[model samples]
Target: MHAIEKQKSPMQSLAESVLDAHTANFWLQKINPLWSVSQPLGKIIEIQSAATDTVSLKIKVNRHFLMGKAGQHHPVIVEIAGRRYERTYSLTQLDQYHVLLTVKRIAQGVVSQWLCNTAKVGDVLHFGQPYGDMTVTPEQQPALILLAAGSGITPMYSLLKALDYSNKISTQTITLMYWVKQHADAAFANYFESLAQQHANFKVHIFHTQEAPCDARLNKNHIDFIKDLSNSTVYACGPSGFVNTAEQLFTSAKNFKSEAFSLTPIISDEGGFINVTLTKSNKTIAIPKGQSILVGLEQQNIQPQHGCRMGICNKCSCNKVQGATKNLVNGVENTEPRNSLRICVNSAQTDLIIDI
Candidate 1:
């Protein structure tokens, strides 16, 4: 058994030898523009407009691509003006070979606007491994409550479609409550409505927050929906405010989940400054108690590598050699040494030394 397990196939041995640094540099220079040694790459196969300011890019992934779960997100790398920027987006698998990335343009979102307006087919892009936990298997629950607002419907859309297409949603009650500013901003409305008409247990409620006569928003007053909280697994996504509101309302639900990527400024009630030392760079600065370390470093003209600007991406996570820090999201303080923390959403509470 040990001898059989230790044997390598001929193709595996060839691949291992070919991918080594000494041999790969020759082949890398030929095809490295669209490929990387450390990450997977994909090429855009098609681009379709989803809504007024949104577009979905269908990509064909390479062999290095790691398939993500139903509601996971991938960080994409794009170069603009000779500078590379990274942005994360939820993925919707179209098939084994293809996946869709839905991007909505924000007011000042550089990567989003470029992807929505300027990106085209056949463009090769780099992608980080996918990660997230807002997923559900068919056997997990008999009933589900999905709450989404604005662009938050991306992941919910993936989960619903995956279940329905696989014929795994029979007799399971799923209620999706989606809120958008206007009717024109709603994507996948026709597809979801068609699914609702065909499936007896699937329902969709779209709330137009900027409609002419009535603008409906989710609140504690959605009495009928709130009554079912005890028996179903509830998932909510959107801006910070929307997720926060849902969490408050469904505080006592059986199972509740939410995902938010909003980068709201950290407001601290505690007032003080802590000394922060970046050991690798040999730089020390004073960071305020209530502000994120990322913001503090930027103010001092020292920029650390980051993506999403939110905690979800984990791109700005660093090792802490010492000191106590507070997580701005949940206000949890940690004083453990040799710990990893997201610098974008954590504030220094005591003198700190970190590997940056």
Candidate 2:
């Protein structure tokens, strides 16, 4: 019996056991292919290619799907070549039955590349609870400014569609400044253009960095396009450099929110090697000084628990029993023993022992 069933009486258990679902564990999913229970699984019902290197998947969530506020992200898990990988994505709710996820193919990105190239209809994947705080709240219903570049436009797209669909703002005074490398790389261009045509107050400005070099980027000259910029709440997402540039330009906005892609540090080979003791695995490996501990472990054919692989998710966090490590995000070094650190973001600076 399942652990949760321990609270029931013998007679109650017997009475409920008449149904195969109550008596048997979740093995029914495999035993009977037609059964659909309240599991946290989603089936891919449709797939659409959105742009040059991007694909949108329409997933029909299970009965137990818990919807989240628009613009929030959910950690999705998919298996490929007998190895499971996890990544976080912002969901666009089509309705209670289905949601949309857009994946942009990154160079050598495991999950993104798989979804864009090989994933097909009828594929089922698991997802964790929705997370992220980039949503628009009722109190923030003022003039809005959304700045997005590359794949960072996803969360902002969710928020934009939710606001427009809910009719929460009658004036439609949302201004979106989207930056892309070229015209072909821009996703959802036609949808944005349609919104601009339907509403007089809704405006969109597209900056093509490659095709129209001189007219691209956000600077002092672009600030004139947004009316009442000081009173607007600005949300920006993109690469770290683009986000930092947006933050600097929108310093005077009423509220500023930003989320950037994980920072990729240039791992240098200036320092000598150090020993890394994996306590649980009862093994030790020599890792280069300037590389992430996770990458170092993987080189030795050891896999540790991880999700998002970016520091945003705490799944890769483990105890540093002794020695020093550095945070790649801020360049801050920690030397105190018996502390928790994210293996994905930190590189070893000295001999270390960790609980993995």
Q: Which candidate wins on lDDT?
A: 1
**Tens digit of per-residue lDDT, candidate 2, span 1-356:** 00121254454355446656434324445553222343467888899988879999999876556666888778898999999788888888877678899989999898999999999998888888777677898789578888998898888888878887788545657998998888888888998998888888888998888884545676778788888988898988776557767777888998988776665453665767889998998998998777778888988888898876556667899999999998765567999998998998888888899998
Model number with the top TM-score: 1
How much is the lDDT of residue 298 in candidate 2? 86
lDDT of candidate 1 at residue 183, scale 0 to 100:
87
> TM-score of each candidate?
0.82, 0.80
Q: Which segments of candidate 1 are over 4 A away from where they belong? A: 1-39, 214-216, 267-275, 286-291, 305-308, 319-339, 348-355
Residues 1-356, model 1: lDDT tens digits: 00112354464455567688545534553554433343467889899989879888999876567768777788889888889888888888887768889999998888998899888887877788888888986456678899998889999988887887678766688888999988889989998899899998888888888887666688987637644678788998887668767888887677888887664445757677789999999988887777789989988899899976658878899999999988765557899999998998888888999998
